[model samples]
Target chain A: MAGRATPWLIGLTLVLMAAGLVGGLWLAPPDYQMGDGFRIIYIHVPSALLSMVVFAVMAVASAVGLIWRIRMAHAVTAAAAPIGAAFTFIALVTGALWGKPMWGTYWVWDARLTSELILLFLYFGYLALVHAFPDRRTGDQAGAILAIVGAVDLPIIHFSVQWWTTLHQGATLKLSGTPMPVSMLWPLLVMMLAFLCYFAWLLMVRLRAEILRREYRARWVEKI
Target chain B: MDSWHEFWTMGGYARFVWPAYGVAFVVLLGSGWAAHRGLRRALARVASRVRGGRR
Candidate 1:
């Protein structure tokens, strides 16, 4: 079963995390502009990237749930909401930490910042909505609409730095080999992989929990 | 000790840097544990009900 793979996946996550943390913290060179403080990018970038990635997961699942009336699809959206929220929180705080030294303020009315904050609140709203009704399916319907609507913020968050004069920097690792050097790039790629692995482990665990909750009395529960 | 202190300092952004990683680590691990524990409890509940129903 999928959940059986979780322990191994989590083990992989831990091992990769230790290596990536070392690579990110000590091996990666300081940025020319930000000095050693720029090491925060290792965590910040992955969290920020995952925040968007998780939302995309939530929105897609919600869409499929609504379209197909699939209970499992809704379960995925529900499971992903809080995970996505945590990632958004990490992104926000780390962004502020990096911002204070670089932009001279912990926050601003920057379009990117505002859109990302809205993303956090969207996750919160979706989560709250998912449990509001006595019938899980009803709540799932409501959350699906919100997740789809809130998805508009994703493109806004991605392009905010480009679309407006924002303090936030644009994407660092474009495919063109344009911006960052190889030394800085490897840790980033590793950290991103680590984040995905961690998310996968967590998601599998959450999915089984959701299944058990939804199907606790079913005979299949005893077999597992 | 001196090199350790320097590493901990994070080039003087220790306050911001450490908390960021700390929060992420805590939340990630905490949530994973919660899911694992939740599953165990739910399964136990189902098992108990199954046994009781059989009797």
Candidate 2:
């Protein structure tokens, strides 16, 4: 890739990822009721959180791409598509898995799950729209419009469970409360940090490749 | 690893938990592979373009 990610950033991301994994796997206390099955929370919650974060990021980048006519911004939004889709898919699958054991069913059209599912569809639709266009700039512009429009669903997804009687559990970890016991909270936090690092690493790698792809004619790309 | 065994056992809730982890595992692995492939392909394309221009 023409764009080089700093070694320091990559190293720091790995360190955070390692800490998160260790904290999540060993340090966190099992749930009083669900026991280790609750361990899945480490991955599930982070994945869900990141999925939303990625969408918001793509939306913002799309806006930047549209407003400033920046090819790099368009590249970022494009690179984000599949990664966001993957994270959303993980969240949905893991949620369903967790739900089955706890809720005694494989699937439920609960508000939170349903809204999250819609988010996934939005990602897919955006991808489809981007690819459907013959002109690259037109594709980026159209996709950007869709991304901005689809962002309306994000708030609904975040607050869906609270706003509706859903099978999904309410947020256990919040800024205000003491949080689940230190043991559980530590791992959960670690996992969240790790997931964020992982996303950074992925995004950088993806963005670097994208920059090279879209800016092949650029001078710096010739050397790197 | 015995961890796999422990995972599937799930303390008698084997079916529900295993599938969840299994799917997550598959998705992560698949995405990792896809990302690697994408990076490599993009690098190759850029490399060739750079080389072709020089020639």
> Clashes in model 1: which pairs?
none
Q: Of the candidates shown, which would achieve the greatest DockQ relative to the real structure?
A: 1
A1-224: candidate 1 lDDT, tens digit per residue: 67678878888888888888888887777788887778889899999999999999999998999999999999898888888998899889988988988888999999999999999999999989888999988899999999999999999999999999988988877777758887788888888889999888778878888888898878888787
State residue A96's C-alpha deviation in candidate 1, in Å.
1.1
Best by TM-score: 1
Task: List ranges where model 1 is wrong by over 4 Å.
Answer: none
TM-score of each model, paired residue for residue: 0.95, 0.89
lDDT of 2 by residue, A1-224 (tens): 32345355557656876776666555565577986677678779988998999999999999999888988888889988888999999999888878877888868998999899999999999999999988988999999999988998899988887899998888867778965888778767776776676677677777777777777777787776
Evaluate residue A62 in candidate 2 and report its C-alpha lDDT on the 0 to 100 scale: 92
- Write the residue-wise lDDT of candidate 2 on B1-55 in tens digits: 1364654465565665556657866886687667667778878988888889889
> Chain B, model 1, TM-score against the native?
0.84
lDDT of 1 by residue, B1-55 (tens): 1366767987788887888788878877787788788778877888898899899
Docking class of 2: acceptable
> Candidate 1 falls in which docking quality class?
medium
Clashing pairs in 2: none
